[model samples]
Target: MTEPAQEPPFLQDPYAPYAAMRSACPVQSKPVDSGGRPGCLVIGYAEAREALADARLSKDTAAFFDGRGSRRRLHPAVSRSMLASDPPRHTRLRKLVTRAFTTGAVAELRPFIARVTDELLERWSPGERFDFVAGLAVPLPVIVICELLGVPESDRADVRRWSAALFSAGEPDVVDSASYSMAGYMTDLITDKRLHPGDSLLDRLIAARSGDERLSEDELVSLAVLLLVAGHETTTHFLGNAVLALLQHPDALGRLRENPDEIPAALDELLRFDPPVSTATFRFSTEALTLGGVEIPAGVPVQVALGAANRDPERFPAPDLLDLDRDATSHVAFGHGIHRCVGAPLARAEGEIALRAVLHRFPGIRLAVPPERLEWRRTRLVRGLASLPVLA
Candidate 1:
């Protein structure tokens, strides 16, 4: 008997596999979960976008697992957050927190973000070797998100640790432990907020009212955990990916350095080129449906390869090449449809400010190690450098 085909090493370099898969078929059947159960991956730009907005594809993962009689091992806080809900519930949870991340709200934060960026860069000097991922990329978002949520400065470290663990691929136990810890911590924080309210986002969330509706305790805790973890995680990786992309393309980096104002516009291309979220969160078909001419059965998980779709040749001419001038607003780096990332505004502001600050601060910065020596994180869902060693 022929041995089972070896799985593609997606964590190492998913782009090549994504290309091959998309070329074969936009929607190809594959084993998506750790259990090796068969599913499908949508790699075409059009198909992925369609699937994202397709009401037939449900984001309610917990309900899907229940239908199969398989107990979902993830914590309810994670499984029940707005990211994992559908319809009325998702609509409600999202509305409660959307005000905090509006374009105007994020714009108001530009000065504070600039100050934080300057503060983070103050530690590095010219001619010094710096691990950009650890020194700046990681800490900047952590500080910003923690402060926004009123998470005590003392708890930021643990929050980061637990958030990292929650995304640890192939470590279900660790994910469970981390999720539980995060949920517990958020619960305590919410309780504290009740006793002594402040002006932080978390405080506002606790006191938020919509007509006659109010968030339940579980909803509140779940939303808090989701915000605290996701708020920083995507921005952290986006910064690392953005920096790495600029370093690899000296010409693009030069232009950005020459005209710092263009950094904001170039952020979209950078995100499209190497998105922080390689694939969107879990989504499954609620009913049997045909997508990209492929038949998908009901309840089967479908993963939209954001990294792959962003580079689909059909959608983007010379997709592989990094062209900053290209109109890349169509990229799904922050996803598409109703479930699109709520923090896109904040993330864009953070990326723009961080990139401009870094380039201005270290005009002579260069990769300290060869591109081959750089390590990417092993998580399947997140694409980011584990450590970006550079000389300034």
Candidate 2:
């Protein structure tokens, strides 16, 4: 007897099927890699959340390259980056950057963030129309990164391109070229930073010490690159995606517009509705372990689908509906466990202020094009509108 062919793998607009998949197989078994062993898909809210915090699953790539499977890099140029490592190395690397992004530490940067938001809004004038993703979401993070890293504003465009390419999902050859270019550019920047130390995040990290524990040369470079990439990419989508969601649902927008104080909750709802990072940072299986009933063997890669888990009915009522007043927690938009984004508070602060400003600054703001016709990111990693053409 033939097991029925699973529906054509869901495409860009796939929130619905994920719910169905979760309903059918909370823990689903899918082929691993090309022809390797089978891996499991964790779709339940609690199950996904549990796996994120599980110590058994490792982010380190050594096992992936080890005898457990082939040695080919899975994520292109990102293989050696921090997101690919686990344990003491991850622990050490995270520590250096974490201090710079500590909760209250990020709070101190709000005024500057507000100022940047104000300046960016000023560029739009009174009745101009522009691509929100390109004009605002993209640059806002670039500027914030320069400020955080102590890099001069003059070099941000180049840095933005570098970080974008490095994290972007594309063919291996293209990604490899971008990785090489970004690495070369970073090496130059690091040299310059060494020569002229400035009052920037780079300087802080370079000088960071925990009783003589300092970031290694590779650690510094990787962290710096990671900062630029992680600092902006996810937040870029958060703002653009949030506004996109609001514009699509006028009542939700109106509710948020009226309450104004509900922006935080609104942001949370936006994250769940259309999270920036559709999939959680990749984690590799340690041993044959069962998640949500399926047995995922050791040395297999498993991903927690944030987009799916965010909408799991068991965790969120009416998972597909966007509620402006939703008390939206339990969201994995920011990955869980020790890897929970250290810059989350800052990212949240930026999104709330940037998005609310767009609404408050232009109450008449509306999408210039039909939602269906607008473009979206092709990659499954970052779920965001490509160019949200809006009239303000």
Question: Best TM-score goes to which candidate?
Answer: 1
What is the lDDT of every predicted structure here? Answer: 0.89, 0.77
User: Which residue runs of candidate 2 sit more than 4 Å off their true CA positions?
Assistant: 1-12, 31-37, 66-77, 209-212
Write out the backbone clash pairs for model 1. Answer: 127-392
Per-residue lDDT tens digits for candidate 1, residues 1-392, read: 23223333665567888898889999988786667778888999999999999999989988877667663477899987899999888997898888899999988888988998999899999999989999989999999889899999999999999999888888888888999999999999999999999999999888976763487889889999999989999899999999988999999999999999998889999999999999898799879999999999888999998999999999999898999989999999999999999999999999999988999999988999877667777675888878888998
lDDT of 2 at 208: 70
Model 1, C-alpha of 213: deviation from truth (Å): 4.5
Alpha carbon lDDT at 365, candidate 1: 87
TM-score for each prediction? 0.96, 0.91
CA-only RMSD, every prediction: 4.4, 5.3
Question: Candidate 2 residues 152-222, lDDT tens each?
Answer: 77778877776665455544455556666666666678789889988788887777767545766776777
TM-score for candidate 2, please give it.
Answer: 0.91
Model 1 spans with C-alpha error above 4 angstroms: 1-12, 209-213
